[model samples]
Target: MKTFFQELKNRRVYRVAITYVIAGSATVQVVGTVLPIFHAPDWVQQVFVALVAFGFPVALVLAWCFDLEDGAIKMTCGDGRAVVTSRRVWILAGVGLLVAGSALTGYWLWHPWKRLSDAASMSSDTLSAPPVIEKSIAVLPFENLSDDKQNAYFADGVQDEILTDLAKVADLKVISRTSVMQYKTSAQRNLREIAKALGVAHILEGTVQRAGGRIRVSAQLIDARTDMHLWAERYDRDLADVFGIESELAQQIVSQLKSKLSAREKAAIEQKPTADLAAHDLYIRAKTLIASSALSTPQAESLLEAVHLLNQAVERDPAFARAYYQLAEAHDLLYLQGIDHTPARLAMADGAIQSLARLRPNSGEAHLAFAKHFYWCYHDYDRAREELTLAQKSLPNDPLPFQLAGYIDRRQGRWPESIKNLERAIELDPQNSAFLEQIARSYECLRRYVDAERALDRAIALVPKDAAMRARRAEIELHWHADARPLMSTIQAIIAKDSREGKNIAELWLYGLLCERDFDGALRALAALPIDGCHQETILFPRVWCGGIVARMRGDTASARAAFTSARNELAKLVREQPAYAEALCALGMADAALGHKEDAIREGRRAAELLPVAKDAIVGPLLVQNLALIYAWTGEKDLALEQLSIAAKLPGYLSYGQLRLHPYWDPLRGDPRFEKVVASLAPK
Candidate 1:
């Protein structure tokens, strides 16, 4: 036994295990993060936990059994005497097994408290939100210093360029543009909340200012964990040196993150874009046109011109992946909007984006283009999500993916969720006129009129001469009060303003206002908008809605019935196909109520409400409650009606706000004191 112990202690494996245990334990303690444990099964986690939990006990047992400090193995018999004592070697061998096992467990349990706490704080839904990311960042809105709002696009271009440059560092995680922009004007979120939402540890924030023939940029890298300002600086240069500014900013971030930059990464930072000043400006301006919420034909055409100049950019420098990516983006935008010949444009754009992607595998734009190509044209939601993830990594500050996420949610009737994503997109590009428009639209859809008004006010201020913003504001106000006068006057001003400038967005504005209530402005818009040659069976629904709204206004039930009959079957089919089609269900319910189909109204209203649980101020949420109340009233179930009305009265600016305004549908219970008491309770204090 003494000889066996001596040999075991002398073995090289004994020394190796001790070294590994010490080094591995220190690594586990110092470098541990959630990264190592993700996507691992519960049983694996338990095995790791068991290893860590048993480390100290095992070490003690090994020490007792080996007598390692004494350089011998002591074996005790049943009589409690040391029956056999071995030499140094065997004792050290047992110590080695104990230490190795202890280190493995320690590594598993590193930062256990923090890991568990972090996991506990997140909701699964938010964790699983679309455009998943490993790293996240927030791009605050660019500051506007230029006198002309038109120059706003230059700031956006600068920001986009920097995002593109940073994407070259493939190992670093990046948040997509859409999520960070939502915080531009947010009064609620802190840095931690922002980081958690974007799922990133670091953040890159910056500001841009435009001056005559020159630009100034200020940028910072933030350590999200500490909420510390890790680095910050300002750059003032001639407009021609914009590329320099972008590269410098990226290099600065890499330095701050202490990232190891490869030769390819270093080369990517210094690549030059177009030297033609006119072409760059044109491209920036073109991006502005497409950025607007309402798709404008003239803007699209202008963007095409910009794309032509961007071609000139690549002509000057064949190595410009950024230019190529933008060109691909422009073509896809045209194709999606039904402007450019889709097949040719899509094929060319896809090929260009793919080429650019190969050159810069970390490019957000490249991944974004491919994701969009599959998402819009191919309807491959899963592939789209994967591409969006990679795109987010490449360019973490652009809002397009967030905007896409929001748009998808809205179409699915997840209005609250959609609004959250859209708002983030606006934060990324606060000065962007397009972002403002989408936010306002989202607010309006969710029936948050105050929020819509605030967004619209900002947009109109940015583009005071533009008629669309003003029209949208007026339309929102009209719905809030259920009155059309304010909307009518705003459109006249819009038409007058457009006539002087030849910008025809006022007609588009009118088309939208007509759709809002269908009753208020459709006839005037129908008289003005283009409808001469196009023939699609889908056209009948808008026409029917227009008729319904008109009849509803005048209390002409029969006319409303006839008009609705033309669209009812189609609408019913639509609701069946997409259960989350809140708009269709809400409209159908309202039409049914007006036509005295109580059962149909109740059913559709209930379905819409369920589908839109998180949507605040939604007409459907309140409308469902209101209709349920009315149904109870008509059926002599006044108690039930009162209950539904009570539920409705809880909504912002709707329930108690309109309690006194009597509508005939609730007349059956008007004489009852119970109804009056319910109404009184609902009215705002």
Candidate 2:
């Protein structure tokens, strides 16, 4: 035993053992700390630690057999007689231990059965069970296998038709097209991950190939949880029979899922949208464009192209109810967004709705169209509500009815109901930033700044380049704590990225600058604004009006008068062209007030308020009244201004703490106790 101990010391085995343990410990610590930076799985760190531990016995064996002498590694010297049995025994034991540890560690880390058991255990736990709805499914974008890639729209149309048919079945929870479209061109589709994200147990994937008036569609339904194919089929048919193929596929999926389908749902699914294939193709393209555009800030050129396509579609098939509905919606958005706020635009929307009503008087599409018409064109919340109720009953899975209901509820000051309806919309269309923005708007109106910011944060995450949403997110800080730094920083960042894109949010940038009393920055922003002006909801401010405000802020009376006069003339012409445009009248009233036309300003402001009263439109109505307050302030009507300001402050509107505290428009009544009290009421707790 003494000789064995001396041999171990002479070989420097103690040093090797201590060094190995220290190195192993350090390696484990380094791996544990570094792996998480890359978001490595928890099991990765555990496996790494096990690997380091498994090396312990191997290090001991090597240390026992070898010696580090001077600068060279050499085998330990032994007497010429025979190798010691005890040393041999100890080395063998170390080698055996190393092999055993390695084998066990590898098995523990990589065993398939163990992984399966763990997964099963997790699935069985009710507290941590995956949210997988048995009857829920997401239809991924069908691959376009046509030679002409431009026919991608045709493939999309096929997929959309199938999805629409499936959505009609009330028993199945079909993920909306907007949400599933993200996975359309994904190079790697993780079935389980996608299913979890979409909260569905089933996933449907397909391919569409079209050539020379013939089409082939292959669809497969998979149990995403188990990666098992439930059903699959391939259809080869003429282009004219595509609708039948979609209907048959929908029926098969419904049967496979064991979903109950009502008679009406079956009929609706089987009903062809258009008899003409060309018309169907056009309708599909138009609908695709509409889906890509945002509801709050729609692309005007895309909408115009969609209108042209839908018109051609309707002309090809006079009784295409869906095409007419799309047409009405396109025109309604055009009018609502002020892209083409003309009577002629409303007339076109009305014509489309009339045609739709004639074709499908009691259809969900008809009710939705009428609801949008009432809400967007007439601001008739009551009529829109009635239509929305009918639409909801017929379109159980549709998100539009709920989204519109939320909008109406917001306008009617039903904040909680609006939030509930918007949340419902989000559940059906999870990827829709527009719904998120609408919910954020309700939170903002209610002065729930944190909730509003959270909603906008989610919206911004969905669309990182959405300048309007980012601007709104920054504006929340201003509204909450009278802070303009965040708004200015966000705007500057956006502008620095692309100055041309700044025009999209020029109004917000100007607002931030004005809030900080940065007159020069406000002037620059106004100069960059579009000549036709910018819009905030229903109100349209001519660029000249913004210029006038900037000049007034700088105390340049001459420039202010000239800019206001120009704005007044332009707005007066617009009012003449659009006599009932309350937004235009409001701008004109402000311009008159700036030019010192006191009576004329007051009369125009009153008329504009009367045209769109709060009773009629709780959303835009308060904006007009707020503008009236500004008009009174400019005209030296202090008491009247304070009274109107008080009323506007109490209502749900764009009124913010930053605006009330910082904007110069209310300078006339700034020192008054009533005006100060109104501003105080808006301060964040």
Candidate 3:
């Protein structure tokens, strides 16, 4: 105002105020946008700039419109009356702008919000070691070196004991049997990739050749990163000294790792198993079949055989607690898979625990198995953790407990922690496809497709015969890129496999349609599903997020919004019922972002993050994390979005890496510095 400016000129504060506002706005916009790059999600940085771009002019326009210049000293209208002049108006405007900026700033910092925008680029890194120590070790899976294949159990028993003994040492980071067994036959991938994939420095490989009373065992340790031989040893001994040989080998390996060891660890290595060699061998065979079965049917056959063998072993050596322990694990595995062998499972678990208690006062495997029995079969979390804790004490080197712990942590919604344990499990068993799948799933929850794909790739290679693995790979490729014809063809091949079995295989068609952006084709595929399961393939909470996916491919946000609304409702139902469906929550968050429901998107994405740790290992995790991260960036939660993307980038493997990177949801984050990092992190190893 001329009057206020005239009066304010005398005070000297008016000029300072305008200059300050201009400078401060510029400073906030410039510094705020870039600063978030270090801490905020990639998308959030873009949002920070956008908010400033939007807010400043509006603020300036208001200042001009209200004519509340000169700190509101006076505002005289043309009528020559002060238009309700109040100095508070100046303060109010400043306060309102600050409040708006602060609110947006908070959004820029939301962790879960950022996860939405970066979900697509999520991935699986580098390593360092303690300088004072040179690590060396070897791991050997129990080889089936029996003529009747009946003695296969004995070989497994030998390996298990050796692994257990090596695990007890504090100085060693022993690669668990699971990781080493990944190299059971052929390893096409380079050692570095294998080592990096396994999270282990050295790999131990061995073979067992046994004939009647005689045994020949040979082992060699190679550094995965350098392809250097750390150690090699062979033991030719009577079957009677089998236990002694394993114990001695473990001790020798521990010494070779070049780490410090405690007296307790040394004692643990020497502790004898309560199993007679013959009985233990039989028990090992049972364990082998029990571990191999995936579904309930095969699992049943294996466990039943285990029970029979264990009974014989028990009869042969009445004091064989190891036999009892395996018997317990078999029943527990079956029950957890919802197999109908509950009664047998329970009886066997109880008997094993009881026998183990008498044989050794503290045994982790028994307790861990007991925990699984209670947790999965009886629906008890506390008891499961408790048992796992005891198992941790007894068999610290065993990855099964940690694997189960990861599962438990997930069920509890501890995403970061669950993922950490799952990662540890992978380190223990690098080639275990199931564990790799789990790691992939964790990244997927954060929406890290890049990382997820690496894990998935490893899994696919491990068991090429696994139709499901191929199908999963197809799904990831479908979502990763809209224009990926090759990926679609891969998915189609996966579906064609099921055609022979008379299964619907509709998800393949639907996903293929979505990738092609042919809504009609998708609808046709959806219609072919068994009524209730149709939505299981598409138009469901997460599957429906592909609607937004489809719309984005078509460059039609309106269609995306409509699909998003439907997805939101579906997500709402999931949140209402279980409230722990992180993938569903994540999908909702992404849909919300596409539709411009920024506030709602952030809120929903946060819930998804909360639920991700506890989410089940499913096909949707990568999409969930990637989409949610994209949302956060769009809404201006830069730091959070970046953090989310970082996590997503490490997902074991993503079904759709390329597509998510190119999606419209991440458009807001494009060209951001942190986004570059996300891209780098997501690039293949």
Give me the candidate number with maximum TM-score: 2
Root-mean-square deviation per candidate? 20.6, 15.8, 14.7
- Top lDDT model: 2
User: Least accurate stretch of 10 residues (summed lDDT) in model 3?
Assistant: 124-133
lDDT, candidate 1, at 153: 62
List of clashing residue pairs for candidate 2: none
Error of 1 at 300 (Å): 3.8
lDDT for model 3, please. Answer: 0.62
lDDT of all predictions: 0.59, 0.83, 0.62
Per-model TM-score versus the true fold: 0.45, 0.78, 0.56
lDDT of 1 by residue, 1-685 (tens): 6644443354333454455457545644443344234744445545554464446444433443543337765532122433334433245446655655665556456646444444332222222333534343455455556778777667667776666566567655545443345565665547775675555667776677777888888887777778888888999999889888888888777777766677766776777656665556655654544444234534456567757766776676666666776677777766554345335676877777777877767656678877777755444556777887777654555568777777666644566777678766755444456677776666655455666677777777656766666776776644565455566677777666554332444344443454344544545554443321111111123445555545655568777678766556656765675566555675566556656677887787667667544253243345556655665565566787777777766653234323233334466788778677766654323
Model 3 ranges with Cα > 4 A deviation: 1-113, 116-157, 187-196, 222-231, 260-264, 271-278, 295-298, 341-345, 439-458, 461-465, 473-491, 495-685
Query: Candidate 2 residues 122-228, lDDT tens each?
Result: 22331122356799888999999999998888889888988888887888888888878878879989999888877789999999999998999999999999999
lDDT of 3 by residue, 1-685 (tens): 6765554444334554566457756766676555545666556555655565456434543443345456763333222433324463465356556655775566457543345334322332201122212463446464565676766556666777887787776556666765566554553546666666555677666667788788888777777767988788999999777777787777777666766667767776777775477677677677666666652222456667777888888788877766777777766665554343235556767777677667755656567667777766554677898889888765766778888888777666576777778766766565678787777766655555566777788788777767556666666654554445655576567656665311334555555565455765555555454322222211134445555555666667787777768767766765575455455566567667767788989988877655544144333344456556778887888777777777767664342355445444466677888887777555433
Selected candidate, larger TM-score, 2 vs 3: 2
